[model samples]
Target: MKSLNKVLLGSATLLAAITLAACGKSSSDSTTSDSKTVSGTVKLWVDTTKVPYYKTIVKDFNKEYPDVKVTVTQSPNGSANAKTDVGKDPSKAADVFEVANDQLGSMANQGYINPLSPAATKAVKKNNVAVASEAVTWDGKMYGYPTSQQAQTLYYNKAKLSADDVKTWAGLTAKGVVATDFTNAYNFYPVFLSAGTYLYGKNGETLKGTDANTAAGVAAMTWFAQQKSNKGVMQTSNALNQLKSGNAAATLDGPWDSANIKKILGDDFAVAPYPTINVGGKDVQMQAFLGVGCFAVNSNTATKNQKAAATLAQYVTNKKSQLVVYKHSGAIPVDKAAQASSTVASDPVAKAVITMSQEGYSTIMPKMTQMATFWNLSAPLINGAYTGSIPAAQYQAKLDTFVSAISKAN
Candidate 1:
């Protein structure tokens, strides 16, 4: 089993963020962490499906800081749409809310969220996965309290294909059908990374550092076009349905849907890190975009309640609460201790997620504000290539256009 807890902290970027956060601690915090006498009425927004379990977690939090009253409610839109929901009106948003790491940069810049207090940031860095800390950091400040790490892995039916067959794309397809969606940029855009190119550069902060317009980018686009004719690959909007019906022997998915798949595949259920695929005549590990889910404190919270709000954010993401979340929702915990617990370490699903979250198998989704623009452009480009609507001759031109648009001032 691949363990998420044992990550090397060697990145200069992550170090710089940690240093700047520590230095910022000398100044007065935007929010205080005085839990003892802190008092406030703070609201927390979580995904609708998560409200119940989170409410139970809130019970645990209130025991520590009874003076703070917290109301756990469902977000009007889910955490996936947090940026949009919060953007509609920041003042009206929850005092503490859930958000994906990719949105942290834009939210921090737009003043929708406050940087985590130094004490909170320090605890986060010390307690979570190295990449989890890095995920919430933007402009050298920690913007959120990370809760879970995510990456898609290959889920297969062991009855139809052996474990060895699923390790290589060619072998899986040759033996049984694999269903997936090319329309999801989330599903296929990592082909560019697998093909050997950077999405916002090595550190993912440089705008022009994106080189999807280069030869490597063209190669990735070409691979997408080639898949349209691959007999073994089935393109479907609902890959899960295909797998459920036995039309597809395998599908790529994350931990969120594990329960449903387990129910469907029963004893035959199996999962593993993505298989190797031949791109540009060389077999390379297929990659997925890794993501971290975090809870951010609103910058718009009442000044009197700042400490209370910060306390709530910190409480729900602590190691014990993270394990609770993992048990109830299958959100793979980013907490180092939680990941190392027997419950997580021995779980097959967690092992696959931890393996895929590593250097060669995945890329952490970049936390650039311009990511909004990249998402708008990436999906259509990938879909067009897969459907051959963009044509083979225009692969370079299409990629060039995409890189140029996203590289502009953010």
Candidate 2:
């Protein structure tokens, strides 16, 4: 982790420099590093388990800007439910809340959060991983400060399978069993990406431009069907337990589970990027949806508190706070400096996730308003194909229907 004072200094400097109006301007009043002028009451929503650590971070935040009083509370639901919870009534939601990257587009479109000012955006871009900056941007504006990354990578037992063996799907399945769930779209939808199809188009912003209804899409579905017959591939909802019981040699998982995985595999634990799979007769790299967790300032926050809320959002997502989140929650840090620190660089799980976050390894999850519909429809579509219920002949038709349904305006 970087020095706390340095990170705080950066946060203080950015806070001092920002003069732009936030999403809602109730008053002509402005906030700066001047503790008295910036004083306001703001609420922060975080995961229940994170309340304690975050409160500690807020304590340090107050030392720099004492007049800004922060109330840290557990969100009504976890971060995964951020969109729905905030949507229920944005004005009632916390002033600053935690959210995942995928929900940003709809939230931004619906006017639930404020976009970062250009100065804040420039600061964020200069400090975090390149992918982190990319993940928080929806359309042309950045709506949140990225704090951590969430990408599923290959977690294996080195004693059972060599690193090279895990490099290709065929190589992995032939040597040992892999426990995974085809019902999970997050785990397998990127198979379409590997097959050379785009989700919401190349830049991932075009609402009607998702291109997954072609021969490439069918090839990806067919590859799923083949996995059903592969003895080395085990369909399981609980992969960690399978790995612990020796029923599977590896599984696809995100950093959230790295701590538990380490305890289960102990001396044999190893991690790697996704393997190349045989799709359309050629080996192509398997990709995962790259998710970045972030902190967003609500557009509905009281106008007088807008600056404080924005500052709090930036403060808690800085490198020091990010490291705290990583230490206490196992979220892979998105800060470039934090990542290069020995604590993170030395961790195999973090290294693999960071590598997987790069281009060609994963795709930034599209943040379209229609993405909610995508999640609801895609898992069943993917599962039906994987389980042979959708059938090989209907692969194209099913994909066509799936794409059309999610492409419609909300």
Name the candidate that leads on TM-score: 2
Candidate with best lDDT: 2
| lDDT tens digits by residue: candidate 1, 200-245 | 8887878888998888888888888888888879999888899999
Q: Model 2, residue 53: what's the lDDT?
A: 99
lDDT of 2 at 385: 83
- Give per-residue CA lDDT, model 2, range 1-410, as digits (tens): 11110110011124452332545523222224433356688999998888999999999989887989999999887787788899998888998888878788888778787677777887788988788888898878888888988788999999999999999999999999999999888889999999999999988898788888998999999999999999999999899999999999999988877889999999999999999999999898999888888888888887688878888888898888888888888788888788888998898878898889889999998888887788888888888988999998898899989899988988
Clashing residue pairs, backbone N/CA/C < 3 A, model 1: none
After superposing candidate 1 on the true structure, give the runs of residues whose Cα lies further than 4 Å from its correct spot: 1-28, 31-35
User: What does candidate 2 score on TM?
Assistant: 0.93
Clash pairs (backbone) in predicted model 2: none
User: Each candidate: RMSD to true structure?
Assistant: 5.6, 4.9
Least accurate 10 contiguous residues by lDDT in model 1: 4-13
